[model samples]
Target: MTARHAGYIVTLAEDIREDDADHIMTALRMVSGVISVQPVTANLDMAIARQQVHGEVRGKVLQLLKELQ
Candidate 1:
């Protein structure tokens, strides 16, 4: 099995022209607790992102995304 890390997954529009996965990853790093980012993609232009974070931060990254929504 793949090693586990504390983070969240993000999805974007398949046809979104400006699908900047790197930018999204950068934003994740700007968050208070995010430490790193991993970009994994699949067919149909879909992406699977994993934002590595500190254990003490718990769900801080998730909380930030919730606020954006």
Candidate 2:
């Protein structure tokens, strides 16, 4: 199958602390094809991670979120 590269966004759950969000962002950056990780200030508990993935990357992003918990 051909590799399809696209942006994947990881959205954190609300009520997460700032420190925890920061830590999550750090871990997200370690994922493959991750271009950037930015915190969403509008929601303290929420953050968005931008990544370029080949094929499907939602699973990976979900795993990352699970790891944060």
Candidate 3:
């Protein structure tokens, strides 16, 4: 016999406004099998920082490639 445990973390494609976060969390709590719902704004900030760093790195690589050509 085996027991299974699983969890999921979801990220939205677009940023949710502060005013709407509570509403969103409330809706998620209403869903079945939802043990808990907590908002983590830090992850969103980290994601944005990561994207900015990625863009900077991409631009630098492209510039380097042009210089090498």
Instruction: Choose the strongest candidate by TM-score.
Output: 3
Tens digits of per-residue lDDT for model 3 on 20-47? 7888888888888898987767577788
Per-candidate Cα RMSD to the true structure, in Å, reads 14.3, 13.6, 4.8
lDDT of 3: 0.83
Q: How many steric overlaps does candidate 1 have?
A: 0
Q: State the TM-score for model 2.
A: 0.45
lDDT of 1 by residue, 1-69 (tens): 899868877665443334656677678889987877766546443322222334336688778889999
What pairs collide in candidate 2? none
Worst 10 residues of 1 by lDDT: 44-53
Runs with alpha carbons beyond 4 Å of true place in candidate 3: 1-3, 43-49, 52-69
